[model samples]
Target: MALSFDGYKLTEIINPNGHCTQIGFTNENEPDVKKRGVILFDRQIRYIEVEEHQKFKRVKVYTTKDAEPMDFDFLEDNYANFDLFLRSIYNQ
Candidate 1:
C-alpha cells in the first residue's frame, strides 16, 4: 500500500525477504485513532525496514507521523540462519 503525506510517499513492506506481501498503512495522517476506533490500534501500525551495515544488522520500526524510531533486540542463542528468524513470525 502507498500513501501520500506531506508531499512524500509511504509504503508498507511485508514479509519482505525482498519479495512478499507487506502489511501496514502508508498514510501517516489519517488519524488512525479515528479510523481504527481504538487507541491501541495505533500500536499495530509501523514502518519497518531491515538494513545491513558494516557493523551490525538492524531492524527498525518507525512509530508516529514524526517517524520516531524504536529499536528491538533479538536474542537468538540457537537460531542457525536469518531466514529462520523471519519464518518464526508464523509460529511454525
Candidate 2:
C-alpha cells in the first residue's frame, strides 16, 4: 500500500523473505532526494542512515499529515537487505 507524505509517496516494498515491509519515499521533482525506512505495526517509523555523500541528511518520516515529527535511528541489524537497498539507492 502507498500513502502520500511530504509531497512524496510512501510506498511499501514487498519482501519475500519476511513479513515486515520497508517503506520508501523519493522526491519526484528531485530524484536525488529520498528516504527509505520502515513502519511498525503500531505506526512507529525509522529511516536508514544516509551517508555523508548523499544529497539529503537524516530527517523525520511523517506517515500522515498532522502526524508528530519524530526522530528515528538508522536501520541496523534488522532488515539487512532493506538497509542495503537504502545504501544502493543513495549511492546512485
Candidate 3:
C-alpha cells in the first residue's frame, strides 16, 4: 500500500503477524545528508522519525488527569492485545 507523507512516497513492509512497517525516509536518497530519523505508523502515527537510528517513539498522550508513563510491554501475538495496548497508551 502507498503511504505518502509531505509528498514523499513511503514503502510499507508488513510483518507476518500483520504489523506494518512504513519506511518514510532515507539519508542515502539525499546523498549522504545526515538524517535525524524516519517517520513510521503502525496502528497510528506512533513515531515521527526515529531517534539516533535506534529508538522508536510513540505519539505523546494528553489527558485531563494525572497519567504516568508506562513501560513498553510486548504483548504476545494477538490483534486484540495489540488494540488494547494502543488504546491504553492513548488513554494515559
The C-alpha TM-scores of every prediction are 0.31, 0.28, 0.20
Residue pairs clashing in model 2 are: none
Local error of candidate 3 at residue 31 (angstroms): 1.7
Q: Which pairs clash in model 3?
A: 38-49, 38-50
Q: lDDT of all predictions, in order shown?
A: 0.36, 0.42, 0.31
Candidates in descending TM-score order: 1, 2, 3
Instruction: Say which candidate scores most in lDDT.
Output: 2
TM-score of 3: 0.20
Worst 10 residues of 1 by lDDT: 33-42
Q: Please list the residue runs of candidate 3 whose C-alpha ends up more than 4 Å from where it truly belongs after superposition.
A: 1-16, 24-29, 34-41, 45-92
- Angstrom error of the Cα, residue 15, model 1: value is 14
lDDT of 1 at 4: 21
How far does residue 15 in candidate 3 sit from its true spot (Å)?
4.0
lDDT per residue as tens, model 2, 38-70: 443323333433333233333344333335553
After superposition on all C-alphas, the RMSD of every candidate to the true structure, in Å, is: 12.9, 14.1, 14.7
The alpha-carbon deviation from the true structure for residue 81 of candidate 2, after best TM-score superposition, in angstroms, is 21
lDDT of 1 by residue, 8-89 (tens): 1222223443323333223345544222111112344466666765544444545455355433223243223334434433
Put down candidate 3 lDDT per residue, 30-60, tens digits, no spaces.
5554332232224543232211212322323
TM-score of 2: 0.28
Ranking by lDDT: 2, 1, 3
